[model samples]
Target chain A: MPTDVIMPALGMAQESGKILRWLKSEGDAVEQGAPIMEIETDKVTVEIEAPASGTLAGLRVPEGADVPVGGVVAVILAPGEKTPPETPAGVEPMVTAQVPPPVQRTSGRGRAGRRPLASPKARRLAAERGVDVAALAGSGPHGAVLATDVESTGRGRDGSTAGVPRTPPRLGAIWQRMAERTTQSWQTAPHFYLSREVDAGRLEAWRASTRKRAGYERVTHTDLLVKLVAAALSEHPHVNAQWHEGGIVAAEEVNVGIAVAVDDGLVVPVVHAADRLELREVTARREELVEAARTGTLRPQDVGGGTFTISNLGMYGVDAFSAVLNGPQAAILAVGRIAERVVAIDGHPEVRSMSIFTVSFDHRVVDGARGARFLGTLADLVEEPAGLVP
Target chain B: MSSPSAVAAQPGTRELTLSQAVNEALAEEMRRDASVFIVGEDVAEAGTPFKVLSGLVEEFGPERVIDSPISEAGISGIGLGAAMTGMRPVVDIMFGDFMTLVMDQLVNQAAKIHYMSGGRLKAPLTIRTTLGATRRSAAQHSQSLHALVAHVPGVKVVLPATPYDAKGLFKAAIREDNPVVVFEDKMMFAVKGPVPEEEYVLPLGVADVKREGEDVTLVATSSMVYVALDAAEQLAADGVSVEIVDPRTLVPLDRETIVASARKTGRAIVIDEGHRSYGVGAELAALIAEDAFYDLDAPVRRMCAMDVPIPFSPVLEDLTVPTADTVAAEARRLVGKE
Candidate 1:
């Protein structure tokens, strides 16, 4: 079998890279570690070496094409071996990866009473854009109209290449699903937001305290908050409850999703069984999950399951605000920056560092009283926080 | 921006004007994915100051078509909030200069939200802002502040000079989970070309060569791309072959493209609209010096705006920023024009 030279993951966060040029063209012999091509990521441009010694048999993606990570862009065949057959013109060459096929056939209906099978996200995108999936070529793995294909600007407005503007393709199915989920959460949940200003002085003070920084792992206040929320959710399982079958149901495990901002969209990867892990384990686990999330190397198991979530904007110094509850998760806790504000300290006006914590919950699962109790418990624990960690 | 090679290589994909392409991409993305929403000043009811968001409100509905208060800070904060809670919000900050009001949210807050949380949270946000000097928008309103955002770790910055890139890059930015700031040059808004009606994404961090020649390389950004193109045309008349390089996305600055072009040409001149001190020109020049130093025939020449604030007067501003004439003059000088 010919060895495929796929687009290398330049950085864990990089999804795609541009092919500046092919150092080795078709029929050119190469060796492993030989500079084969130049790839540019969002932050750095590095040369990718040939994975193995072989002749450049075929260029799956042309010079200047932007290909996703793990997507095959070229083929390195054994000496004198033949390249694969040419793909149909105007269609994107298929990547050998396991991604579902790109949807083709611009017409929604196909011959022989065939209904074009597409991902629910892709179908929804097609319907919303009025795009006939059958009419276009599928760039995805198998002949599926990938969400990227649905928004591709293949033709100009005048139906002619002349004077026509190239429109960029739109968001994919993942973004569409995220939007729908948030919309559903906002629409369904009787959301009553309560914002509180906590004394971040203690959180910050603890972070500075030598006791917290005993090793290589530097646990942030956000990490502590995740642990605190997990403990709180485990203790008060009501907040970890989910809405189902016309009634509220609670879960036993506290799998908390940490909302991480990536280049394209937010991905909340779950810290499975957060309540069970000690603070040190929680810190290490959070690091591993975050590394995977930002690099887009997150496995299905890394992101797929979650029961509660935490979002911290405090480091960015957001004074205070409410977050939209990511749907299905019973509650989402928003943490704001630790700012020094004048408050009554020992019955006297004093400037003390404070951080705001806002929790947006699915009101159907937990009432205001219960929600307040959760926040109150969180506040009590966070203010001291020593009890929960030990 | 328009590149001769990109135009030549894919003559079919280079026709749309940058702004037209942005509008088309936004419209297409919004239409296709209900999850992608645009919230910016004058984006909805007012159709956008640059008219890029025209008819978006009617098409995507007000829920996705959000018009906000004149507060850049407030709107940016709102974009952050919406992004954190699950929605991908694309914000337009009217002018690049006004981004200062919200830098706290963008540079400090939006940029570091993910890493600081040790991977527990992410902010998928895109801020679209305008940068150029020729519109006579004057000192405060017209500035290329992409360098500021580029300095932030979590934020990805993309600057588009052509319609082809604007649309594709915008689509990519909307899909990114980290905060992305796209710098749209005011002058390139009307430079129309052919853009495919179908979906395509121009990945971030890639550079496109608008024109190719041998003697010298002209690396430009935004409106300066057009200026460099004009300079290339003028130099062609003089038999001096100048290669024009557009580093489309400045943060993921395409060092390979710049180095390749520089190595091929042996000389490079960076043209930008920002003030000369530590601007994008400085960064590009530094990279070339560090990586492609052996490839240079002469020291890398960076032709940028003078170290002075943008003036309200047209004549003063004219003298302050780079013009096609100055670019040609500088290119000619570097290539021994005088």
Candidate 2:
């Protein structure tokens, strides 16, 4: 029997993987475990290996085709073995059994018979609400009708007026996944935000001194924060825990995910066991992850097993912002830009570098008191980072 | 048995498995009417494989809860003859796959008796059968053939999804003047649900809104009812509110309720365990399209079993029928979420 080469599932929640390219051509003799194709999932792109040592035949799916997880992309047949007449086992036969010819567009009556692809509900709502569906562009696949399209008829996202329909711009894979994850977090995870403004004088000095060292020239405040957050998280295991199926599960390893903004959207790549890694190691790992994220070549391990996330918008010069929790994770720490501020020190006006740190916690996992204590620990570490940063 | 008023006032207080509910309904009916009796192969003691009629023989004795030969046709013919002569016989066909054998007595004879005899003759017979696959019974034992009997006019078809509906609908079937075929999902016999202790009868051809929502209407029957409900729950997490309408009865299907739900939601997906082509789903989809076409936002979709025979392998059998995930995916597509 021919061995079916299926689209491997790399991520836990991945449904499909897009084929990047076939490493080997059809009828090529290949050894088992040899990389045959490159497939990209929502999380990362990885090379798929040949299941058996055979001549690869029946390459069913083409390059760039997004086949579902476990779906057959090709078959590996023994030498002189013919391609079977029936579909390979585990493949949906119904999907391959029939192929209807594409409909050709005709003029006059044929053209008049063709209607805009809108859902039945959308059409009904449009009629009930006295909205012209034809005038509204759909956001659904192939411009099909959507209930939202009918409800929001005559109003575009940019507040454009009626008569001019606007098709919503398509989102890339990362951006779409980000949207779905954020929406899910917002809807399901009850979030509670705790904000604290800490003196960044010691943190800045630590970063500056660390940058002066050889091979640590790129040490950043975010990297310093990752180290500090990891230390504080080790002390506060409750904050490092995740909300899993209505219970708090303390993650054994404090894998801190750094939110990196790529061209497409936000991608969080984890720095595994940040608490154990040195400041320079954290910086090096962050750089590698950010680079991989930007190039869309992040491995599955780079994005998975994140117990907590740190999103630093300080580079953008933003004063302060609270982020949504990266769901399942108990908390996410958002860092703001460090700026000079005058404060009364011992009843005298003194200048200090101040930065606002906001931590968003999943209320189900971490309570207000626990979150405050964690934030207090983080603030203390930020104020006087003597032994922690070194 | 508790009084009808007591149970009716606080229905669904008591929980019972579908098996227990059906057994209770039979015992209640036989006690209420002396003319009512049970006839099937091994139903007297063995309870017909699923043990749905266990202990019924002790309550009504062997004469009333009689066991018959393995011939489905013979038992069905006997039930039809007894019904015509004034007995309300509840004929038990062990598996719905065997319903094909009783077609002559059920469809040709029982279904056409009243009409052919100019309303002078009536067959107050109820055939309790089972439908649904994934039982590893292979093609011969596992088949959802309710659509076959439902196609005939004189006969009525009711599928009970819950224990409450199972008991109530079974009682109503016995009281029905015309021939009624009750197709129960054999796998659901052990499924427990809230059933009132009091005596009650659910009217035929009435649809039950198992769960109410607005985004889309899932018109599921029998085994598919639970599938649709599971899908609805999943879709709810995605922010798509799905309305589940279970048309407990198929023949005199409650077109009004089904159509109204489709109109209200503007989308409908009919789910059935029968084969996709010419199945209950196709008929429901057609009815919704014909009645609620203008109100619909998407074309009516049908999620039914594959046309192939139910495979014997557990892995292969699972693929032959619609599941919660598949139903949810289809619902998501209709609502424009996918």
Candidate 3:
């Protein structure tokens, strides 16, 4: 049997693709899964692999021809099978005007009933970006579609709300756990909030000047808080303790869980024994953890044993927010963006760069006074800036 | 594991050797029903070789517990005739190997009397046979041949691993109207286990979960149940909980209990005293595959006795049979716990 190769829809918005070049010519022996041709979609130019191994026999679509996404481009014939006559006389490869958007279909990775096989994150991203995951062939191990495979660039998603609840395609394992855990923490833990504004004028300047210094990449506000929070927890171990049936059980060391938002939900990767690390060390470790979280490769050790947590929406430009307690962690600090604001300094109106910080505590373990003290120390450390430095 | 929550858990419970349990079950059944008679080779005087029916003839008298001639075919024919003539006869095949001599009486007559006679004749006969390996009993005498009878249409095969199961299953077998072949492990005769003093018939076709666990399910038949339980304990120390299900009867095999446990754990290891190919393990593995394929994360595994005949040398004999260590190792491989 001859294997038919169809053009792939590169994005959700892509209805057709233009044939760029055929890597293999007619009558050429083709190995399945090897790059056989290149097609230019509205967004990307990708080399398409052969759907089956055989001799590339028929070239129905020619180069520079625009064909429907699902239109057959060529056929691979078995060794003894007859090939159709070459690109017959003056035949136009142009898709007819009456042709509708190509029906999404995936070869080599077609699941039963055409459901498509994709990883959880990939499924969720495809749904959010309106990509037809069922149309794309999987490229991951065991034919699993990854999140990166959901190309939103040319997916034709107009960013219009469907007038229905805009739910993500899938919650995935990470988000499913997040929903159950956060709800349990909120419903069971007697949560009380603490908010404060700190003068971040000096902290911001220090980070900017440090970036210019030798051997520095980028010093972020989160890096400074990670260091300060670890120091604060060390000074107030009660805040680093877990609430148990017995009572407040203080952790011996500080392992801070930094909440990062991925395609699906918030994943907190722990920086174990953060108090022992200097500012630069904390920055490097935090960056690695964040990258791992984004790539969905955080190991069990990367996320377990969190005694405290930090949720920063500063990069998203949020003014202030309250974070739910993560696991048995007695407290979690929510950091907001720093912007210049007019404030009264020693009874005089003054303009200064300030940032809002809100901290939530499990009243079962951390009392109002202790939580306030921890928050006060953290604010002092961040405002002073020098105290956070190694 | 400690015992069934009630009888298996009762305080002051006395231990009975598996053979003694068999003797007790027989005596109890014979006393309850005058129609329940014993007729087998040397069963009346010698208690056959395992002494499982010892003292039964003295208590029930020679008329009811009649000893039969040496020929297995004649003995089986007489047992089936008595069963068809409104008497429940317990036939003891001296060795599992000798059961072949009585196959015609069992498979063609005893197993099919009711079916062939269209309810006019019912063979309420129970054939008690011995099976095991590593007893230093040579090939012919040490074969576990329950599968042969179990494969026949109307025969119910019972294999009890513990004293508790021995007493209960034997009673159930005596009460059953169809021909039930009870396979008693030769090596298990002297093994002592908790048995309730009260008479209770464990329902045939029911499987007992010797140990409750979550990681993997191990379905063991006959003597392999003990091996599986031991393996479960060893796996427990490594943080792997193995559920051990013992199908007391092979014919009316409790596929539900076995498949349920397999589905719950997503992995199963079947241990049987018979050969690995087309034997008890193969049947059980096929059962799980057909019914619980999607539930499995790995292929169902089987650890069966080596296909070679039962060897006379003690070390070789031990190697011929499935062991606890082998069972645990297979369970680990099945569940990837290793």
Clashes per prediction?
A: 70, 9, 4
- lDDT by residue for model 1 over A261-360, one digit each (tens)? 8766677878889888877787788899888767656755677558988888776768777888877777888988887789997899999888888998
The sequence of per-residue lDDT tens digits that candidate 3 reaches over residues A178-291 is: 887899999989999999999998888778877776555666778877877888888998899998896889998899988888886778888888989877778888889888
C-alpha lDDT score of every prediction, in listed order: 0.76, 0.85, 0.79
Which stretches of model 1 miss by more than 4 angstroms? Answer: A1-390, B1-15
User: Candidate 2's fnat?
Assistant: 0.90
* DockQ, candidate 2, vs. native dimer: 0.39
**Candidate 3, Cα interface RMSD:** 8.8
The window of 10 residues in a row where model 3 chain B has the poorest summed lDDT is: B1-10
TM-score of chain A of each: 0.60, 0.77, 0.60
Docking class of 3: incorrect
The deviation in Å at residue A264 for candidate 1 is: 72
Query: Compared with the true structure, what per-residue lDDT tens digits does model 1 show for residues B230-330?
Result: 77888999999988899988877789999899877767899888778888889999888777765554568888878887888988888888877888887
Give one digit per residue, the lDDT tens place, for model 3 in B50-79.
Answer: 777888878989898778788889988988
Off by over 4 Å in 3: A1-390, B1-12
Please give, for residues A1-390, the per-residue lDDT of candidate 2 as tens digits: 888898888888888887767899777999999999988787777887899999987666555446778887678998878767653443321221111212222211222124566777677677676666665667676667677777666654344575334554445668877888999999999998999999999988888888888989999888889999999999999999987776788999999999999898899999999999988899899999999998888999899999999999998999899999998898999999999999899999999999999999999998999999999999998898768756
